[model samples]
Target: MSEFIQEKRQYPRKSLEKTAEVLDNDTGLSLGILEDVSKGGFSILTDQGMRPSETRNVTLVLPGPQGSPHKVSLTAECIWCQTITERADFAAGFALRSIEDQDEVALNYYIRDYQVAGQKAGELEES
Candidate 1:
């Protein structure tokens, strides 16, 4: 028998046209490519594994109003991480813990305007 799983996400997630790059703020190193994002959290596809409950200061490079890249800084806590056997990469989910007012505004704009499922872009349907 198949069991039903309840959805727990507060905000809807939107995938990007080109994967956004996630960076470790402290080290300025590339952490991974942002797979999808929402107001509350985001997920990353990375080469390195992340432990659950781990906290990080990260910057996301997102597509801006006119094809330019905009960076949004925030503190995030890792919620889960799993390995993709075929790709040999890790996919990690993180919840937003903190963000500056300006960064938060920018993130909201990116989600509303540039995302694949966003009104302006309207490229891919939301998953």
Candidate 2:
């Protein structure tokens, strides 16, 4: 196992209010945006849905201030999930994979914005 050094930066995570889509590769399902996201992955809150076990494609459109948004399409896999009592949602962990260098740059840039605003890189989730 290789060690993934967590990027040294501010953890700016904001609760997601906009609607995002998650397209299922096998069943063609679109899981709505739950809440919170980061360059690492996201937390999906749903009534209760089965997720893919294998590595699948996950696309997310992140909206920044000033109507400037960056769309990211990358490969990720469902690692684990759990339902918490505090919130009625499934907090899942996803290992980002096959990310384009440009996408990584964009992710960094997004975080940079937060840093510029004296915040950290977080999207209602963890990075």
Candidate 3:
């Protein structure tokens, strides 16, 4: 029997599926999907495989409160990478290096809003 160890995260991540771009110094731009997000960092599923320990700047186009998309940029370092067998995409975990105050607020709002909505839905289903 094998036991898997769970990593403790500083912030809880909420599932979010949104298109984003990774700005690579050598490769220019790489497209990826933002799978889950938190105020601290987010996971990206990309066609290009990012080596572990690689760092890059990512720009996330996230939906705003008014329904318009807003751009948030952050420097991130890849913690781990794994190839998805069934798909061509590679899943990568990124740790956010730095973020602006406004960007942090926006990210927190998006995560909390989703969590609240999900909880409400679950309650409705149970009722």
Best by lDDT: 1
Pitting candidate 2 against candidate 3, the one with the higher TM-score is 3
What tens digits encode model 2's per-residue C-alpha lDDT throughout 40-125? 66556654544656576666666667767667667777766677666545666556667899987886675444432334545223
Candidate 1 lDDT over 10-68, as tens digits, reads: 88888766868999999999999998899899999999999999999999998766678
TM-score of 3: 0.75
Candidate 1, residue 57: the lDDT equals 100
Candidate 3: residue 94 lDDT (0-100): 89
lDDT, candidate 3, 61-115, per-residue tens: 7766666777777788888889995644688888889877887777666666653
Worst 10 residues of 1 by lDDT: 118-127
Candidate 2, which ten residues in sequence have the lowest lDDT sum? 115-124
TM-score of 1: 0.86
* Model 2 spans with C-alpha error above 4 angstroms: 1-29, 51-53, 84-89, 115-127
Every model's TM-score: 0.86, 0.57, 0.75
Overall local distance difference test of candidate 2: 0.58
Pick the TM-score winner: 1
Better of 1 and 3 by lDDT: 1
lDDT of 1 at 79: 96
